[model samples]
Target: MFAFVMRRLAVAIPTLLLLIVFSFILMHLAPGGPFSLERELPPQVLANLNAKYGLDDPLWLQIWNYLTGIVLHFDFGPSFVYPDRSVNDLIAAGFPVTLTYGTLRARFKTR
Candidate 1:
């Protein structure tokens, strides 16, 4: 049983790394953090906000930091669009919703 689990883990490691790389690229490309859309913050304040989040870090360091953050602390950092929730929690909710897709929708659909 341990061997089987280990074998799958071996395969999954690379897949997870790929996902991290893709996620880092996509998140960095977006305009700003969850607070970015706030009308209250002035332009200069927004620039400071980005820097505080390490948005200006080199791509490799950013990706490495992101990957390590999850493995070491089980965090994917905060939500870029929902400051109140962690990225890990948001991602966790999405999987079951997506996995059960039509079954969930069909139950509430009217004829």
Candidate 2:
């Protein structure tokens, strides 16, 4: 059991890391950014905003910062579209609804 658990952990860690890396890449590659829906601000204001969020850093550095935040703090960081709420907060808030929906679907399917 110990050896089996250890082997699973070894496989799981790399799979999780790859999933994170791919998701990050896909997110960045998609058109539009967090501020895209907002009204145009001055260039100085935009630059300042980017700098404050470390969005101005090189992509690799930004990815490193994000990964460090996740690994060290269990933080997925703030929502890009909802600046006031962190990703964790949003997930917590939505989980109940998700659970309910899944439960109902399964119940109906089995009926």
Candidate 3:
């Protein structure tokens, strides 16, 4: 039983890492960036915004930083859409509603 659990964990860890890396890559490859706006911002301002979020870093470095932040500090950093909030803060705020809906759905599931 212990060996089985360990084997599953070994596979799961790489799977989770691949998922995170692929999602990050896909998001960056999309058309518009988080800072894109109808009216163009000054170059300096755009550079500052990118630097602030570590988006100016090389893609590999960004991924490393993101993974380390999660593994070591459990930090999800800040939300690009909401300058005032961290990703963790947003998740916490919505978690209660999510839990409520999830519980209700499970209780009423057709199966």
Candidate numbers, best lDDT first, in rank order? 3, 2, 1
Q: Listing every candidate in turn, what is its Cα RMSD in Å to the true structure after a full C-alpha superposition?
A: 5.4, 2.6, 1.7
User: On residues 37-107, what C-alpha lDDT tens digit does candidate 2 reach at each position?
Assistant: 76877789888888988889999998999998988988998887788999999999999999999999988
**Highest-scoring model, lDDT:** 3
lDDT of 3 by residue, 1-111 (tens): 999999999999999989999999999999978888577788899999999999999999999999999879989999988899999999999999999999999999996
Query: Distance from true position, residue 88, model 3, in Å?
Result: 0.3
TM-score of each: 0.62, 0.78, 0.87
CA RMSD (A), model 2: 2.6
Instruction: Write down the lDDT that model 1 would get.
Output: 0.80
| Candidates sorted by TM-score, best first | 3, 2, 1
Among all windows of 10 consecutive residues in model 2, the one with the lowest summed lDDT is 32-41
